[model samples]
Target: MEETILVLDKIKKSFDGVSVLNGIDLEAKRGEFITLLGSSGCGKTTTLRIIAGLESPDSGRVLLSGADVTDTEPNHRNVNTVFQNYALFPHMNVETNIAYSLKLKKKKAPEIKKTVAEALALVQLEGYGKRMPSELSGGQRQRVAIARAVVNEPEVLLLDEPLGALDLKLRRQMQLELKRLQQTLGITFIYITHDQEEALNMSDRIAVMRGGVFEQLGSPAEIYELPRTAYVASFVGSANILTGRCAGGGDTVAVDFPGGTGSALRRDWQGREGDSVTLAVRSENVQLLSSDDSRGIPAAVTETRFAGGMLRISSKLEDGTEVVISRYGIGTDLVSGDAIRIDWAAENAVIVLPDSEVAHE
Candidate 1:
């Protein structure tokens, strides 16, 4: 069984009379890569601060290694944070920066030098230790920041959008690097990010936050495939959300929505007759067929675009609801104003409750 390294129990916080965190709870396992994903002002950063002892919660407790540390000071906690700005001193070289913490603890020069060298090698910057922050590239500087944070070997590493400052290509590269680094070092990582792809790519599990609360928390596949709420479905990935009423079925629940009625596998909350619900279907799950196909819903093609390895089609249903479809490979012959029918298997459709109706755990 995995060991629990950190726990946030019903953490609540407010600032200036405005609530930011609403009784959130999370338990992180040792060496786990968990991401707090949400848009701006969603309390993800505030939660990180609370974990690092940089911010105090109005209620609840923070437990690390099964010990309560709710009132611990930031410096006293066995945790380190790496910010987006790569907060490195321009005057200090990489070796000096990594050795700073060790030196402050009054470690011998030989041990500091050996530890610093090991850290540099771990981040793939073995010989670059002599280089100053200004002399290195953006990616290198960020790696140096990571090296400095890891030199002390904190139990938990809190990364606050460490790749936000890098360009698109570089950011993509760093995402894999960070994940590999976490696995290699076996450190518990609590990452914060607003980017869905980044969270999906790097996280072992994700906590999707919204309006100061966690909308959903699950593995990447679970968050994308079986979101518990409509907000989670739309936020964590691309989903075509449609309002519907439950028609009630045995193995599958029939949802009556615009254009047509669709069947979804029943699980958890079985819907009552005529109860309102939401249907979330991924773009790739939507299949476009000939207009003559009677089994599909009629829709008018609005636009089609080639997205490198995939083809994206935008269509509008008779009720004016827009539906997007994505397929891999070359472009399709369908164009604007063309008539098409869209359909999907019952298994591909996910039934979710409205955000207001979703019960928090």
Candidate 2:
């Protein structure tokens, strides 16, 4: 059985009468890398901070390994945070910075030295003990920050956009490194980030937040493939949305999209024909068929761009709604203004709702 390491029961937090976290309930299992993925002001970082004890909740409870820690001080909680800025002491070298936490515990020189050295080795900075933060690259500095946090071996770890400062390639590299470190350490990592790609790449589970509540929570595959909400569908990745409501008796329904009427099969959706709904399909899943293989729907190719790995073509329906289709591999025969059929498999299309939308109970 997987043990629940952290639990938030109806957690609420407000500032000056405006609520930021509106009754958030979530759980993190032991040794899981759970990411809070959302845009700014969506309460992701606030929730992470609440778990860290940096801010006391206005209501609700926080449990750490089944112990109530809502009133505990930041230092007393079994969680450590790595800030976006790395938060290293500008005046100290790598060794002393990591040793600072141990020294606060009053450990002797031999013990602190061993712990710091081992921590450095864990982050692959074994020989950088004498180097200052300024002497190291951005990635290395971030590693030292991780080493500092991991040296304590807390029950949980928190990272707040720690790689936001790095470049694209470095960010990708760090995401892999972070995933590896989490597995090797077996610590529950509660990461918070607004980057969808990074969240999908590094997390065992992802909680999509919107308007101070979790829109949906599941494994990366589940959230990506089986989004429970329209906000999540739009937020997680590129989803071409079509709005309509259920048409009776069976799962097959005729959806009214901006483009045209289309056949879509939805799974267990609780909606009536008059009830508004949205359909979501990924661009990559959309197949661009040749004119000979065309559907009855009229569409015109408006633009095309080569994305190195794939050909991205922008199309417009007769009704003038934009549809983007990404075709894999080499195919340069398409020209602007050419007519084509942009169709996706009925099963590949997803139905979603906006933030204000409700789900079936």
How does model 2 score by TM-score?
0.90
Against the true structure, candidate 2 has what lDDT?
0.84
Q: Rate the local accuracy (lDDT) of all candidates.
A: 0.89, 0.84
Model 2 RMSD, rounded to 1 decimal: 2.8
Maximum-lDDT candidate: 1
Poorly placed runs, candidate 1 (over 4 Å): 329-335, 358-361
- Per-residue CA lDDT of model 2 for 169-238, tens digit only, reads 9999889989999999899999989999999999999999877888899999999997877778778967
Alpha carbon lDDT at 139, candidate 2: 90
lDDT of 1 at 31: 97
Model 1 poorest ten-residue lDDT run: 352-361
| Local accuracy of candidate 1 as per-residue lDDT tens digits, 161-234 | 99988999999989989999999999999999999999999999999998888988999999999998888888
- Model 2 spans > 4 angstroms off: 258-260, 289-296, 318-320, 329-340, 358-361
